[model samples]
Target: MEETRSQVDWLTRAVEALPDEMTFDAMQQLILSMVFLRQVSDVPEGEAQGRPTWEELVGQVAGKPDLVHQPVQRALRAWSGSYGKFRIDLDNEAVLGQMRSDSRVVDRALRDLIALLDRAGRAGAKGDLYDQCLARFSEDRVGGDYYTPRDVVRTMVGLMAPAPGDEVYDPACGSAGLLTEAARYVETHGGRPADRTGPVLRLFGQDINARTRSIAAMNLILHGLEDTLPRDIGTDNSLLHGSDAGEKYSVVLANPPFSMRMPLTDAGFVFWRYGPPPKSKADLAWVQHVLGALKADGRAAILLPNGAAFRGGAERRIRAGLLYDDVVAAVIQLPSGLFSHTRVPACLWVFSKSKRAHAATRVLFINAQDTGVQVSRGRRTLTGADAERIASTFNSWSKHDAADVPGWCRTVALEEVEAADFDLQPARYVAPVAAETAPGEDERRVRELTEELYEHFAEASRLEHELRDVLGT
Candidate 1:
């Protein structure tokens, strides 16, 4: 955690060092791209026979800054395949040409950042280091779109409980954080963390933006222990009106873009597993897309906007089909500000093709809107203990007939669900704590009820007389 904070602080210093035209996104791409090359290459950056590696070349520029253009250009050409579509200002910077005739500013910034990374590396903070960079990089940016706070990712990953040889995927994997955590899950479960040639783990991801995809690839190359598996992060939209790929996985964990509106490019897409979603609001569409992509007996935990829970019309129909199919396993109401991108409430919908442990006729409802500790004005995050508490509740409930905690969680039968129009709002089923009655409270309640009933009877007589006059009786 301190490493991440330090990285964020240094990233701010790096951004302040650059020209106004440079964006945090652009700066991040350049730095991480270099970091990726340094990590993936077998040879450390060095002064090798006439062709020094990029890091060695950067070091050579400290004093004689005017001569950096040629070596840096060579490095870009050498590693172009690895960095693909970075949209970086320099492909690499030519000191004299684009550095406004002063190369030291760029040189000093890169030197300092890389130095910090080297120290962190020896300090054992090398795993997924750029997650910190990306999180901090988005802080001042207009929208904190790709920042899926790490704790949320960790909790979601814990809930999925992926095992060795289990195929894991994320449809809208920003920076591939979910995939990174899933890889960790495999390692923790007595499986290899990474296998370059014959990996026991399979990682798949798709993001609509090519730039983010490239960034994700670079991020994965460095930290995820990805040297073992063939990475399959793609640039195409996974919800492409049809099968994104005929691929399915053992586990599907995703927090897809919510309330997205794109034209239905595949009108005959045949999303009948759940049902086709409206074009204007694609929340259920992504949900259906994920559901359809799951193999029989597969399990998934999806993050969704609260509207997907109880919205009327087409969404209502979708909810009915999910419940009827018995694939809707649990609904967890997350706290507000869990996401820094939008203040809209969030929830988790866990689906299982075959629920062998819990009864299919009933689903778990956990109202955790009060779970997180506020960290900022409009943001909050679940600490390790906080997440464990929430996760333990669901885990115990799923694996055994765990006693329900009043006012927090409840198991609602399908009949009750149907009575509520299949509404998934957690509060609808999980009642709040009822205050205990004081002494003599029962007599007070009876007296209040008798007086109220008599007043209602008198009003009924007056209404009857008014109706008779209106009917000319």
Candidate 2:
């Protein structure tokens, strides 16, 4: 924990050292790319002996402050040849060229950052540090697009429960948080071979954004995953284009962009089975793409907007198709504000191609809407305990010790789902159960409720007067 704090402090100082003209996007690229370069320098086989490593480059910068770009670019190119290209393009004028004349500024920042990382060593809490960078960017409201809060990533990973030898894929890999967490899950659970030559789990990921994919690559490298699984991340549009022909995975985890619109013609690949999702919303499109990407007997945990669970029209039909096929496994509604910069209520949809006999005919609905602890005025996050409880409930149900905990979780059969016109929203099925409370607590609740009621009554009275005046009555 202390290591994590120190790393964040180092990152703050590094960011502070940068020039004010650097946009968040450029700063992100610059910092993350340098970090990646620093890591790659440790591997001896990347280039012939004479080429300068990260340390050498930092030393070289002290003499000729203007000479940072070319050396870094050359090292990046040579290493990329030995260990496949990471696409952290130094040649991109937008990133480094904007400050080429003021190269001393950029060089100084890199020197300071690399010095901190070097002192921290190879095993520094780099993944957490990278995530902190992403979170800080999200707080600034510029990076929420690709940053999935780490807690949310952990919850999704726990549900998937990735194992050794599982082919895990994330269609919308983002920062590759879900993929890396899955790798860590396997490591924590202990099945990796002592003499492991290749990855214990085959991890693959695809994202539409190149810069995000670069971040994902750097993240994987920082986790030491590149040693076993080099260049596993790609820039494929999982929805518009299919993965390398006929490829499939045993586990798929994703938090795809919510409420994204797509051209109907572009999304026709997965439409034959699930039908085309509405152009205004690609929520179900992502779900179907993941389902299609799964191998028989595969399972997935996907996060989507709450509306996808109960929304009408094309999404409704798609939900019906998923339910009828017995592929929809569970829907866990998370609290609103769980994401940093957005207030969109999200839910996790666990899908299975082949369910065990116990969960084969039913879908588990978990009402974890009230489960998170507030971390800030507007942001909430699930604790480790909260995530474990949700994972255990689903795992127990899958293993046949199914119990319907009132207001929290319930395994509803296909018939009950059909009876409700296939509304998979947890609240629609799991009614809130009041908990036993102390007398003082109950009194406080009653007072709060009374105040809320009066507030509603006052609003209703104001609206009535406004209506009367508009009608001249």
Candidate 3:
């Protein structure tokens, strides 16, 4: 854990130094170059004798005249000397040069670099070089508003408890953070890293953005997900351009892009389980896609806008279908502004094909809006403790005879939801408590005094205006 933290720190620093305008693909290339340079610098002296300094190597292929190659060169020399017996050869130079010069070369380099780093990480290397590499790249490129926060990912992973044999997926995966987190969860939960085989071979994801698909693939590889390689990590524009009717997974977790639209074609017909989402609003469309992608026993967690809970029109029918089908498990209200890029209040919807020990007629609702701690001046986040509390609540509620905690959570019957127009908002069903009122006499006196002061101020302002008019006359 300490090593992971350190790697994350290094990644943060590396990304901080990179230009924010860099695309995910460009950032991946830069990371690949950095890793390759570091590896080359680690080679023995006899092998690396003819290798140029880092500056010279970068200068030779950077395709830019203004880039200061000298500093890089000096840094490389100093680093190599300090580390001892570091070397590079012609093949290494060619690889490094190609990675720096062309984007395609960088992609190949990134794949190879990640494969190497994965082997090293599993072998118990000093720092998580692969994690740092990806973190640095993510830091450089600003992700979308839908980018899932790491803490949220951790919490979701914990709640889902992805096992070794589970086939995890994210239909609208953004950089595959949830997928990577799921992989980590499996590894930590008594699953051998070497047991990369099994039904778990299925680590599926799809995204509308090609760049994001590539980034997601890279993210998966960085986290030691070797099963989803060059091909299985689908980047087909047609999939997003068309429709994917027959896809399923054991575990599905996603935070799809909020409030986006797509053309409705025959491909999109498969997502009409709850009726087609409005062309103006694709929120329900994504939900339908997730539900359709689930196996008979699959469990899914999706982050959705608050409106999905009670919106009228097509969305309402979708909500009705979800409740009627008994796939909805829990609805967790997240804190507002949890997303760094947007201020929309979000919620987590957990769905299951097969109800656990609890009745399918009941749904767990947790109001976690006020549970998170303020991380920045105006930004709040769920701490590990808060996440654990929420997860515990959900897990407990999954079992038979789960009790409700007043003001925090409740398990409402499906009939109650049906009566309430299938509204899933926690606040709607969770009874509100009456606040203690101040003494009546004191409150009345204060109100009277406040009204008197307002009258006096208005009169004074009127008199002042009159006096000014008189003076003008």
Candidate 4:
């Protein structure tokens, strides 16, 4: 791991050394594109025998400095056909033209990147390099919607418990984090290996940002999932556009952009059957989309702002519809500051198409708002133990063994939820653990408090009587 970090750091420095004219977005694309091109060109020894490697191209650039941009562009375009096309503009001479004066710097950066990858060798296929690059860049970017923290993704994946042969989908798959985490979770739990030999689970994702969608493709490729069809991981607006109505998956995981306002005109009315979400807020719109995209027995996990749990009007109607359907399985309220971009408290809404007989009429509420440990000034994450605790509580409930733990988790029947007017905030229902007291200790404490109060009352009366006598008429 240290070695990988060292490599990433060196490559990051190379990117940093570029001319000032290059934007962060351009620089990011340049670095990732180069890394991806190198990985693709490295088609093993004796394979793709005639194809020029990134190393050979860079070596030739030293002799013919003027030809620096063309060869690399051609190479990337050539390799893109076999892998996937990058969405950024490589032909934009305005950016590439600016490098003419700093050709040597560009050449050195490319060479250094190639050397780093050469040292990385076959391990580059594992994607740690790319993952770290995306993370490092994302940390400094403004709105961090493009990257979901790995720990959060892990917790969601752990709770969902996807298995082999299950079709998995992420509607707002920023950099494909959720899908990759799900793949990793399956591998960790003794399912099929996440290799090129056809992944055990069929993974699918869609992102609206073309550049981000491209990044998702590279992410999947590096994780030994290059064989996934292009159509499966697309750039369509998932809310308004999706697979045919008959198409659905057994597992879905998503962390869509929060509080985004977009036109709902393109979306089918079927998705809004329960109610149309307000144009100013699309949180519940995303919820209904996920619910509609599930198979008959599908299970899903979604990360949304806390407001979705108790918002009024149309949102409440949707919540009621979901409850009546008995599909809302669990709502685990997460800690605040879990995201760097926003401090809006978030929660995980787990849905099940077919619930067990014991849990069908009930919904599990886990008040984990106080569960995580602070990792930095304003960021917190769930430790493995934290994640396990949440998952175990849900597991226990699924097996009909759930017992309410004050201030933590509770199992509420449909009737109780209705009585509460469909308020799903776990804190409103899960009581805090009462303070422990010894036998008869409560009575003794109350008696002592009562005597103290009586003494104060007597003092007040005596003072009033003395004042009245002094002012007597």
Which one wins on TM-score? 2
Cα TM-score per model: 0.81, 0.83, 0.69, 0.81
Residue 336 miss distance in model 2 (angstroms): 1.8
Candidate 3 lDDT, tens digit per residue, 344-459? 78888998889975666789998887777775544577888888888888877776647788878888999999999989998886654545667697788588669766866996
Task: Summarize candidate 2's per-residue lDDT along 78-153 as a digit string, tens digits.
Answer: 5553344354454434576655366677666656666775654455555655656666666766337777887888
Worst 10 residues of 2 by lDDT: 81-90
For model 1, the local distance difference test gives 0.70
lDDT of 1 by residue, 234-317 (tens): 566777743346677888888887788955586556665666677788888888878877889788888889998988988899
Give the TM-score comparing model 1 with the true structure, all chains together: 0.81
Whole-model lDDT per candidate: 0.70, 0.76, 0.64, 0.75
Q: For this target, which candidate reaches the highest lDDT against the unseen true structure?
A: 2
Root mean square deviation (Cα) for candidate 1: 12.4
* Clash pairs detected, candidate 3: 43-87, 44-85, 45-85, 48-87, 48-88, 55-72, 55-73
Name the candidate, 3 or 4, with the larger lDDT value: 4
For candidate 2, give the lDDT of residue 89.
51
Error of 2 at 39 (Å): 2.7
Better of 2 and 3 by TM-score: 2
| Per-residue accuracy of model 4 over 13-92 as CA lDDT, tens digit each | 66656666778777777777776766666664356566667566656655666555667766766665445433333333
**What TM-score does model 4 achieve against the real structure?**
0.81
For model 1, name the residue pairs that clash. Answer: 195-228, 196-228
